[model samples]
Target: MTVIVRDLRPGTPADIEGFIRVRHRALPYVFFSPASVLHGLSLPRPDAHARKLLAVADGEIIGTAQVGLAEDSREPGQGSLNVYVDPARTGRGAGTLLVRTAEEHLAAHGAVKLFAWVLDEPADRAFAERHGYRPSRSAHFLRLDLACAALPPLQDPPPGVELRTAADFADDPRPLFALDAEAGSDEPGDIATEFTDYAAWVDEYWNHPHLDRELTSVAVADGRPVAFSVAHTHDAGRYRTGMTGTARAHRGRGLAKLVKNDSLHRARAAGYTEAYTGNDADNGPMLAINKWFGYEICATEVRHVRELG
Candidate 1:
């Protein structure tokens, strides 16, 4: 059987569904939906040059790749190409074909350094190393059975701090943006991103298809948002932690834990039965917090990078 690689047609329902299926099977810890996929493709990111590619055999999509530049990073010529092959369809050269196509696309866009996330399994690590990529920091995907796990009981905020939902900021989300930007800058990762464009943030994150403002908890102190736990929900009672952070001045106040716990309790009340979150291996504070919430590490992925000559 001959396997071929091609660009995914955003207008085709089958193409979108097939891509989502392959991705979910390959990385079940993360969330994926038709609306979220389309939303990402529709957004105008000229500098990113983002493209979704698929590997097909017998007209069936067997693998997928998301190729794009890290447009928000301060560094220049950095790109990302993550490839995932359906577990049942591996060993047919689809993975290799997808990687080759993704690299070509990123190179065409002037990428001097390439980064990819590979599963921590031996075979996956070997595949990345064979492609000239070296392993970097690793992250763990944590999952909680929201319906059964004993979540930390919701606690009242300390004096001078009040708990609020992201919906409270619907009229003016700039404060949340400021908090997100500040916290995101300190996040552990290969790419350092800057969120200078509030308009872009509004379009990409605040308006995301899966963002559940009602369940997203925010902690306000000194008349501003000091901590938050962003939430995203999809079909099948699934809930994911998009981000959880505390502002610089708000650190060590237990606000991060307070807001996240509040969000989790609300999510359970709203019928979400499964919760998933990812944490960098080096992020000890966040990891400890998640473990305390009864979340168990279900999967791990290592970031790999390769420099272009």
Candidate 2:
């Protein structure tokens, strides 16, 4: 059977469904849906330079890759290509084909460095190393049973702090954007990102198809968002923690935990069965918070970097 690699057809329902299928199977800890896939393709960032690719074998998509430049990063020439192959269909060269295609596309678009997230398994790491990618940072996928587990009790905010939903900022998300920009800058990662474009943030994140504003909890102080636990839900009873962070000035106050706990409790109350989130392995503070919530480490992925020059 010949394995063929091609650009994903955004207009085709089958293409989106196949891409989501491979992602869900290869990385069950994360949440993905056709709507989210399409939303990503529709992002308006001129620098995004995003492309979704698929590896097909005998008319079936067995692997997928998301290749794009890190347009949001202040640094130049940084690109990302994350590939996932169906576990049942490995060893057929689909993974190799997808990576080669993605690299070629990125290099042609002036990408000087490429980053990928490889599963922590020996074979996955070996494959990355063989492809000239070196390990850098590691991250963990955490999972919690929202239906059966006992979530931390929702607590009243401190005297000056108030708990609100992301919905409250629907009129003007600039404050939330400011909080996101501050907290995201402090997140542990190889590439540093600064969110300066409010319009882009609104289109790419705030209006994302899966984002559940009602279930997203925010911590407000002095009439400004200090911390938040962004939530995303799928029709299939799955809930994901999109982003959980505390503003720089608000760190160490336990607000991150408080908001996340509230988000989780609300998610369960709204009929979500599973909760999922990912954190940098070195992000000890957030990891400890997740552990406190009884979330178990379900999977790990190591970031791999490859120099284009």
Best by TM-score: 1
Model 1 whole-model lDDT (C-alpha atoms): 0.95
Candidate lDDT scores, in order, read: 0.95, 0.92
lDDT of 1 by residue, 1-309 (tens): 999999989899999999999999999998889999999998889999999999999999999999999999999999999999999999999999999998888898899999999999999999999999999999999999999989877788999999999999999999999999999999999999999999999999999999999999999988999999999999789999999999999899999899999999999999999999999999999999999999999999999999998
Model 2 agreement with the true structure over 1-309: per-residue lDDT tens digits: 999999999899999899989998999988788788889889886776888999999999999999999998888889999999999999999999999999998898889999999999999999999999999999999999889988888888877999999999999999999988888888889888898999999998999999999999999999999999999999989999999999888788899989999999989988999999999999999999999999999999999999987
Residue ranges of candidate 1 with Cα displaced over 4 Å: none
Note the residue pairs that clash in candidate 2. none
Off by more than 4 A, model 2? none
Which pairs of residues have clashing backbones in candidate 1? none
The weakest ten consecutive residues by lDDT in model 1 span 149-158
